[model samples]
Target: MRKIKELGEFGLIHKLSSQINFRASDSILGIGDDCAAYPVKSGKFEVISTDALVEDIHFKLSTIKPETLGRKALSVSLSDIAAMGGTPKRIMVTLGIPKKISVSFLEKLYSGFNEICNHFKVELCGGDTVSSPKCFFINVAVIGEAKRIFSRKGAKPGDLVFVTGTLGDSSLGLKLLAKNKTRGKDHKFLTTKHMDPTPRVKEAEILGRSKIDITSMIDISDGLVQDLHHICESSNVGAQIYEDRLPLSPELIRTCKRSSIPPLPLVLNGGEDYELLFTLPADGVKNLIRQFLKAKVLVTQIGKILKPGGISMKMKNGTLKVLPESEGFNHF
Candidate 1:
């Protein structure tokens, strides 16, 4: 048998899915959804999620500041709440730091975390701290509240799929960082995107409150194509995304042109965009588009859900192409 490295991230997830027994009564939904939900009092549910960040793996101390790292650790977990159409309430953090790190650095890190928490009105309940033998590690767990939840299984055939904001900026920012070169304009915007990603909490709240009947929702922590595959596999459906209709920011276009990099790969495969991707019924598409436009968030109708099968991309030249499989991120 071939090892997981040969299959990559998505293949490993698919293989692992078969062996795991999802057997928690409290877990109304599990790995397939944005957040795992448990029933609570007053006809409401509680959501719990966690994400880990490691030194030199998820980030680097050379380029990314401790404050940005701290903020990112919390933001990624909060994105899960947004994906589930839930509101965040509280969080617990766990830290494993090397002795070489200074107390001031740690304080700055906490400042960043608290800054985001204050912005989102989330409480920091408690957490654990320890010494790591080697690299630094940070883990954050967030709890949220939801009256009703969204899952990947609800997407139906013919439903329109949409994404919040633009794609590829983070990846483009990363390329700039790697090359140790910077451009004059749009550098701050892209670098901030890579360093400190903002979760779409307000947008998610609006979507949830509107009772818009969302079929499915996910955050683009993974690449757009890879994350969409989760919805397709769970719903037993496929998708077709139009290349021309994908939302692109002016900054992203300018950065890509300056870097001489193809925009498609970054837009499709770039991780940590932290934008929301969702599906809604065909009839409600126009109204939703209009509402999103009014809100000043670009919502692009990139594709449609179809019956169970493979994903295909439509080219500008009127040809269809199968998307190559790639994993967004792998811890191991």
Candidate 2:
């Protein structure tokens, strides 16, 4: 048998899923998009997606609290539902619990999950708990309802690409945690953005309901360039992202400068921001900007879709070059 490390996460998934044939009539989408979708009787679609987080790989208990870890686990799965412009309804969380862990620790973790569920108005419908001899892990399955589905396949060459909120804060947070610096104001904000990510459910719901057209959409879990590449590959197009147009929080900039780290790479290649990256027709850009302004949501038009099949970055000094190959958050 071939080693899993050789295939990587996406390659392994593609290899395994290629062998299975799914032909359920009710299943409108399966195995490729962010969620497996089913058409509901009410003319809407039901989207379900699952994500998992494990000890030592995704996080470490030394840096993250148990409660925060629980919330992060659920947030990751819900973020996938958000990418479809769906309204979250319910979640099923399966836990691989270590016997050595205390009951109190587990209770705190459950409390964290409950906290986020209450905020999103999502219910914990069902899940399974099992014993783990080695390490702790969480698997969350989120089910949501979407009136208009926004998949990565809908982007066209002329579409304008936009992203919500700022980028790279989560990755910056991870860096600070690695260096054992998590007490100052900037450190706290950046680290919190990483440890307790918020799903953009409300923003996605507004966009789905808005009059402005959204061609394609995805949440930024696998870095900006890599996720945009997903849209490009699915839609059979290319993109030109402006290096200067990338949105970065004040804390991110300050932290990066202080650490002598270039913020651009983190903004482009860092993962787990959970912000929305979407495309819209050129004509709808003004109207969408107006709508976002009205909603008090921050958005930036950072790029435009291109013809052919690759990604390029336009530098601030008026130079344009092709993007290097990116391996975004490989789980293998």
Candidate 3:
């Protein structure tokens, strides 16, 4: 038998998912997608997705407050619905509580959940709570519907790649937290990026309902290059990213200078940005920009889909280099 690390997270998913069978007639999509979908009624498909966050593994309780952690727990899961261009209707949460956790912490966590739920107009439908010998973890599931679902597949040769918001901020934030250097304006911005990530639900809804056709879509939860690779593999296409074009915040650049860290590596490989990475034909670029700007969301074109081959990047120095997606975060 092959070990889990040998297959890696995505590969393990592919291996096990292949053996599983689905008999549900309404099921339009299954494993290997951001969300599973099935047609509900009148051209809409109900999409569902779930994710788990564990103490120490996914986050450090020492660095994050219960309220912010609670908000992030739901926001991360909701990003899946956004990737499929769906609006969230409801959510369910499951908790694995260890003896060390306090009742007040749980209450504040749920309070955070209630606040975000109200903001998104999603109901807390159902869930379960269980005791664990060690490790506190949370699993959040969301259900939503979409008129049109954008999947990883569908990129054609000439499709332009775009990403919402800046990249690498969250990754930098994680590094800062890990080092116990949580001070300064730059640190605060980056730390907030990691702790309180915003799911681009509104942006996704507008793009999905707009006239511009989005060929492929996924959220950058696993780094920009890794998520883009998912779209490429599913579409049976490749891509070429422009390094300078990749979005970066002034805070990120300045903070990296202070820390003596290279920003590009973090931008390409850091996870938990939670921004949407998408593609459309070159012609759709203009209108997409206008739509995004009106919504006050920054959408920048950073790459282009190429004929089936390896994924590469054009550096600021004008050299092209093939990128290895394995450098990204993987559970295995």
Candidate 4:
């Protein structure tokens, strides 16, 4: 038998999905894309996405506030709906709490969930609370609707690739928090990023509504290269990203310089940025960029798609290096 570590998260998902023989016609999309979509009414589709955060693996109570944890737990799942170009409407939360946790903590956590849901105008209908054997865990599921949907399979060879906001900040932030360092002026920004990531709901909505044809879309929950690999595998194409073209925030650069860690690896392989990575036709790039600029949204064109199915990065000195397919977080 193959070990789960070797299979990785995606491989494990594929393995399990292979065994499921029951799928209805209404299950229009299942187990593959960011969310599962089902037709609800004429010209509209209902999409649902779920994500879970564990105690030690996802966050530590000592380092992170309970309220922030609650918000982040929901934001990550909302990002899935955003990736599918859907607007969040409703959410259900399930919590596994340790017996020792206080009522005050639960109240503060629920407050955090309310804050985020209110900001997005989403409803927190209901959920279940259970006693955990050891550590606390949270699972959030978001239901959304979209007139038009974006998926991973639409990119063509000549399409251009783009990413919203910056990459690697959240990953670097998590590193700083783990070490308990609190020195640099930018450290707070980094820590906040890791502790409270904003889902790209509005940005995804703009792209979905834009006239420029977005060929494919996905949020960068995993690293950029790894997430882009999903687009490539689904679209049956390849990608080549330029190292120089990648957008890195000033805070991330300064923090990296202080830590003496090369930033490229983090940008490529680090996870939990919650930014959107997408592709569109080369001809539409100019208009799309213009549209985003008008909306005061920052989107950078980093690369282009290829006919071949692989992932590579072009170094500053002009050497192309192949990125390993499995170079991202494995949740197994």
Candidate 5:
């Protein structure tokens, strides 16, 4: 008999997912991709995904406000829809409320939810609320529609890997918040990034509508290297990312310099960036840049797909170092 820790997060997921033998024909996608897609009469696939945020693990009550938490709770799940090249339509929130929570907190939380929903034009459907013994948590389910769907299984050796926005800022912000150093002017932007992450819904929509052939996609919720590994695993291809090609915000670089820590670790291994990590044909790079530029979204080419079997990083010294799958956060 094997324990869960021995199997690891992906192993456990594979184990459980393999046992689900009752998938229907209408359910074209399930378990493996960011969201499960079902074809509908509207000439689109209805994609659905859910994510849970727990106290201490996902956030600290002392660090984040209830409203910030609420927006983030939904944002995380929305990223999944974006990964599937979908637009968010409706959302449902399930709360594990502790006795220590107040009505004001819940009200502020809903206000945050309403603000985002208005911007995205998403409907606020009903959900369940339950009392908890101690720690509070939130589970958000988002339903979306995609005219053209993307999955993790499409990357080829010639695909060029791209990532949206800057990496490492959010994770570094979380680190700074833990030490209560999030008050200064320099820390403000990074800290806010850690709290309020924007799901790349519009950007994904642009890609889906564009002529570019986006081979594979996943959001950077679990770190760049870790999430990119998912693409490699699914597509049966390898990747080689250049350290210098990784996009980093000035604030993240300065913060790393000030703290005397390396930025690469945070950029490659830290989680909760919520940006899009995707792959497309090398020929489509020009068009991808043009489309995202008009939208004012930054998409950086950090790597390339290979025919081999492992993920590697090209150092500044021009050495290729293999990155272990254990680089990212393990939920277990």
Candidate 6:
């Protein structure tokens, strides 16, 4: 057998999925979907999503504490719920820890999880703990409720696309952390961004309740270009993002200047932002902007959905160019 690295993450998933023979059932829409579907007796639908965080791959133990790890594990699952325009109600977390990890470290991790759950009103249901052979791994499954669910396939042409908050801070933070470690320069904002990320749960709730007729929604876990490409591919539509409209944080700009790197690429292609990227009807753009403004999050109008095709970026010089296809954060 070849090494997992040779196959890459998505390739390995495809390889494994090809080997499995799934039995057909009324409840199971398994394998490729973002969240698995199962029948619920109640009138309302129930959703379950899980995400795993492993040491070294997702985070470095030297920089990220156990508590942050636990909180982030829960947040990533919650982001999936947000993508579906659902409210998270409950979560179950399973931990794989090395034997050398202390009880106190685990307690702090649970405390962080509890804090986030309390903030979101999500209950910690149940989970299992196991011993890892080497490093730590945390997985969280979130259960959510929705009256009308949002899917990636719902977008249409002429829909206006928007994103919550600024982009590239997280990626710039990672760069700053690496630079600081190597050059002994202290950059607090960048370091904080790498350690802690805010999930746009409130924004998701507001957008869900506004009844603004959103066509589709997604969380930017991967780079903006890649994540938007998901919606484009699923909905069978193309997109044209205005390069000038991309929102870059001041911190990101300053850091980019300091590092002598162009901020535009980082803003466009960086991942782990955890911000909401969604599309709404062209008619409802004003109302949506007002709603988000009241929530104090600046929503940037980056682009519009087009007829089914490839993605293009309108450069500052007013030229359109096709966006190259690329994968983001491939885990093997």
User: Best by lDDT, which number?
Assistant: 3
Per-residue CA lDDT of model 2 for 60-103, tens digit only, reads: 99899988987898888889999999988777667776756665
Model 4 misses residue 69 by how many Å? 0.6
How many backbone clashes are present in model 4?
A: 0
- Give the whole-model CA lDDT for all candidates, comma-separated: 0.79, 0.84, 0.86, 0.84, 0.84, 0.76
The regions of model 6 sitting more than 4 angstroms off are 1-43, 181-186
C-alpha lDDT (0 to 100) for residue 128 of candidate 5: 58
Please give the lDDT score for candidate 1. 0.79
Model 1 over residues 1-332: C-alpha lDDT tens digits?
46434555445434433333324344454444444454565877788899888888888889988879878899999999988989887676777867676655766687777677778877655566676888989999989887778877789989989998889888878878888766677887887898889898877876877758899999998799998998898888899999999888898887778768799988888888999999999888777867777788767789999887778899999899887547465445
- The per-residue C-alpha lDDT of model 1 at residue 126 equals 50
Please report how far candidate 5 places residue 332 from its true position, in Å: 0.9
* Model 2 regions more than 4 Å off: 1-41
Tens-digit lDDT track for model 6 on 152-213? Answer: 88889999999988888888778766655423233566566656777787888888788799
Off by over 4 Å in 5: 1-41
Roughly what TM-score does model 2 have, to 2 decimal places? 0.87
Tens-digit lDDT track of model 5 for 1-332: 56544555455445433432334345555555555555565788889898999999999998888888878888888899999999987776677877677656766677678667777777555455676789999998888899999999899998899999999988899889988897676699999888989999999999999989998999988899899999999999999999999999999988899989799999999988999999998889889999989999899999999996899999999998999888898898
- Kindly provide the TM-score of model 5 when superposed on the true structure, using C-alpha atoms: 0.87
Give Cα distance to truth, residue 226, candidate 6, Å. 0.6
Worst 10 residues of 2 by lDDT: 16-25
Please give, for residues 1-332, the per-residue lDDT of candidate 4 as tens digits. 45544555455445434433334345556555655555576788889888889999999999999789878988999999999999987776777867666655766677788678778877665455676889999988888899889999899989999999999998889888878985767999988988999999999889878888889999998899889999999999999999999999999998888779899988999989999999999889888878888899899999999987598889999999999868888787
Q: How many backbone clashes does candidate 1 have?
A: 0
TM-score of each: 0.86, 0.87, 0.87, 0.87, 0.87, 0.84
Single out the weakest 10-residue window by summed lDDT for candidate 4. Answer: 16-25
